[model samples]
Target: MSGGILEGDRNMGLIRAQLRRQRVLAGMNQDEFGKRTNYSASTVSAVETGTRAMDTPFAARADEVLETGGLFVSLLELARRDGQPRWFRPWLDAERAADQLRCYQPTLVPGLLQTEAYARAVIRCDDKLTDAQVEQRLAARMDRQSILNKDEPPQFVVVLDEIVIRRVDEAFHQALADQVHRLIELAERPNISIHIVPADIAIHVSLTGPFILAKTADGGWVGNLENQLGGIVVDKDDALATLLSRWETVRNEALSRRQSTELMKEVVKSWT
Candidate 1:
């Protein structure tokens, strides 16, 4: 383990090494350390090996279990910005303050609707991403879902191209099934409405890409446009108008809420 700290003490490698040292000095193996921290042995091993990022709760638990005097917590605080890309961070605020959120996904499940296992599989598809990077993004996605679980959640409206459900992760089939099942469950919530655009459509505006718009608590709106590299926050008047127009076009093609729920149920059968 490197003793010298990175400039901001933000390097994840430091977190990994420090955790390993604390475990060893405490005379605990991964399983024992995990038990004390309420995590699995595999999770401990992953963090130590730089395969999984250390989240705040785990860091706080480690401080208690390892008696590090909150050192681990401090380190994670400095490195917290790495949890999500800078470009996408602004959107998270918009999501949390939203009165209503509308989204269109042509390729896969929306982040708010993903299960942990399913989120992992989708995130790992990026060959260039390290396991640690994958876990960081996955954690951010999971955290983003909390907005929906709030006491007064935003009304979340999602429109998916039929292929989103039809395309399943073969290697993680069961997780994919669980994800579809989750969508069905979420559809039952009063504040959530999910619609699916059938596959037979020849050509539609949704084929262009995916975008999300949130009507904030202040009665203003913000939109997001994502692509291969990163995403842009859409707030300019003309841009938002264009984006809203596009969303309406794609949403118009979707099956009604009742029909969509039945469609999702039918899709789950294929997965089984």
Candidate 2:
């Protein structure tokens, strides 16, 4: 295994042991600790066994209730962030474990579905990242696709606006054309679904940007919204419901999977 994988595994074990020890020191059983922490006993067990990692808020709550002087949470924060922004960890967690992923992209292809060349170009265009930083970001973005290749992979659904395909720069236009054709091929996979909204469509949900809705195994859903400033994850019941409803409407306006693929082919022809 690579050094990164080895280091990540080691950190996971450390966090698990810390959490388990604290729970036991508090004289708490799995169920009791889970009840106190607002997580399931199974989830707590997974974290403790190093099969899953804990999130920031959960780590803090665990520290407070377990009375471990906040040590575990502090250690978890240090290890999780490593060098990137804190938000990256939760996004990764959701991407890795989701049973289904639905995305609506008004501007570009969703990161998980992007080709490496396209992803690197997109990252390079972002002023926030240096050349080296863009390379790292590209690697992380590509790694996010593993969930789709797993044994029981997530059902991947993506809806793209025609504008996203139409706005490519001429320098990379041929590459983008190839990229879109590749996406059409991906849509043909049994586990994947793709939709494209017509440019002339009169109705759309999110006019300003893109978002993702991921469904977890426990009937829980989460929304990811990104912007120039930052991004937010919405797990609140009402917010998730609202996003889901809007997505349904948008999906209604998009072409069927077959028609979407045909449309993409035509769009690619125009690129040449």
Scored by lDDT, the top model is 1
lDDT of 2 by residue, 160-182 (tens): 99888778776988668778977
Worst 10 residues of 1 by lDDT: 1-10
lDDT of 1 by residue, 1-272 (tens): 01112221347777778888888999999999898888999998878876667777889999999888999888875554444566666787788889999999998899999999988988887876656567766765776787898999999999998887777556767887888899999999999999999888768976888999999877888999889877898889999998888988888999999999999999888655
Each candidate: RMSD = 4.7, 13.1
Ten-residue region with minimum lDDT total, candidate 2: 1-10
lDDT at 17, model 2: 80
RMSD of candidate 2 to the true fold? 13.1
Which pairs of residues collide in candidate 1? Answer: none
Local distance difference test, per candidate?
0.82, 0.77
Model 1 alpha-carbon drift over 4 Å, by segment: 1-35, 40-49, 63-80, 169-172
